[model samples]
Target: MREISLDRLRTLVVIADLGSFAQAARQLNLAPPTISLHVAELEARVGAPLLTRTRGQVRATAVGQTLLERARRLLADAEQALEEVRGQVAGLTGRVRLGASTGAIAHLLPSALATLQRDHPGIDVQVQVLTSQASLAALRDGRLDVGLVALPQTASKGVKLMPWRRDPILAYVPADWQPPARLTPTWLAARALILNDSGTQLSRVTAEWFAAAGLYPQARIELNYNDAIKSLVAAGYGATLLPQEGEGPELDRRIVCRALRPGLWRSLGIACREGDGDRATGHVLAALKHLRQ
Candidate 1:
């Protein structure tokens, strides 16, 4: 049997992931025919078809799916080995893919990334804003090197989890409205409520908080961005519950930030692949860990 080619294996993985030969070619910077040839070569070597192409997408067969999984591991291992060598000889140099929530990206991540960039300028950090659930899913799919997500997450096998930070969930209400000093769920629920997107973890937690108080808040509107929620709240649309994020602009003078009764909190933490102990990823994780306060 002919030897399996690593480049072809990587090509197969990218093709399977993107689901388009043209897309895979563009991603790999190869010609479209080259992508097809790579798959053909792999099929010939394994004596089985690896990909079935359709009108707009491509999918792997059973044998191809198994091989694609193995190929990802192999490629990850090879890349780790190269990164290790670079770290030993020069310094940590590689890209670390990270996933975070909008709040984390706005408030928590900048400080850590600032220090990481100052220290290891060689390491490249790619960040995407995703909800905790989405981040966890990406981590399980091996798309993210590290995830700063809301806590109480169930780790997929081979994921290393650590506690990071706890943030108080605060309410934003119209500044002119004198919300009761003790903000009870029932009191808040009696008012028009605005909440995070309906399906987000934050929204779920918010719902639980209301439910625990024997009341429920049916939001007049749900939004994912904090600023937009604040804007809507300031316009007297309704009150909202959000992590206390203060960045781009001053809290709308018309909006009052208040802590909830019973002190609702959200937990966030770092998660990495268990065996990923690569120096580059570790350096980045350590940088984030240092900022855990």
Candidate 2:
């Protein structure tokens, strides 16, 4: 059996993520040839081409994807082993950059981070609020140690997405606008709405749902920030859709939040680079799961 070097495995993971040796090399700070040599060495040992390259983009072969999964587990276990040893001697200390959407940032992340901090005081954590796609992209590019994103990401090629939780997508109406007994397409179309920006998954889903129901809302304004939407709705500017749990005190007092009648909900969860088989990701995931439970 050929011994697998962690360095080679890391190289393969990086290439699988960035889809180009040059990009991976730049990320790893290695010469492109050096990175290529590492991948070639692994391919030689595995006896299969790990990457299928055409033009400038690269993708993992079936065998490569399978190996990538195992490699991620192996790498994570390896890092955990090292962390365990280090902790036994001194302590675990490192920074982890995590990304989340506005909804998660408002509802889920603070408690999760507080719990993690209680357990691992030495570890520093930073959180970035972004759209689900942006969060997934950051995770793949190795910028984030982990992220919480809505499901059905367009570029989830090398990611391990798991269900985090489901939250209701509520319709927010201004105080003056008399809302219907039920929020239906016909009823909602009569009112002006402040829709989420086109970039977010929420915006796409909302548009799809409305389109499917043959409802075109009266246009008022467009905004990316959910908080802004809530604020505008409160001030009687327009109605909007937001997560059920995302109702702030001020918004909750002023607006009526009700579940969308046609059963629209967002499935969200934690994700990380498959290569991040590290103690940090595992511990954080476990903590998150515990919180959800």
Query: lDDT of all predictions, in order shown?
Result: 0.84, 0.78
Give each model a TM-score. 0.68, 0.65
Clashes of each: 0, 1
Compare the candidates by lDDT and give the number of the best one.
Answer: 1
Q: Tens digits of per-residue lDDT for model 1 on 1-293? A: 56788899999999889898888899999999898898888888888998887787789999999999999999999998987777744545878899987777887788888999999988889999888778778877889989887778776787778998777888889977798765889778889988998867788889999899888768898888877788899999999988764244578789888888988988778988888467888888889988776
Lowest-lDDT window of 10 residues in candidate 2?
A: 244-253
The TM-score of predicted model 2 comes to: 0.65
Give per-residue lDDT, candidate 2, residue 81.
84
Writing each residue's lDDT as its tens digit, candidate 2 over 1-293 gives 76999989999999998999999999999999999899889889989998998887999999899999999999999999898668633435556788887767777777777888898776667888877888788877878878888777655667777777777787999766767656876677777888887777787888878899887564578787778788888888878887765334555567876667797887777787776466766667767787562
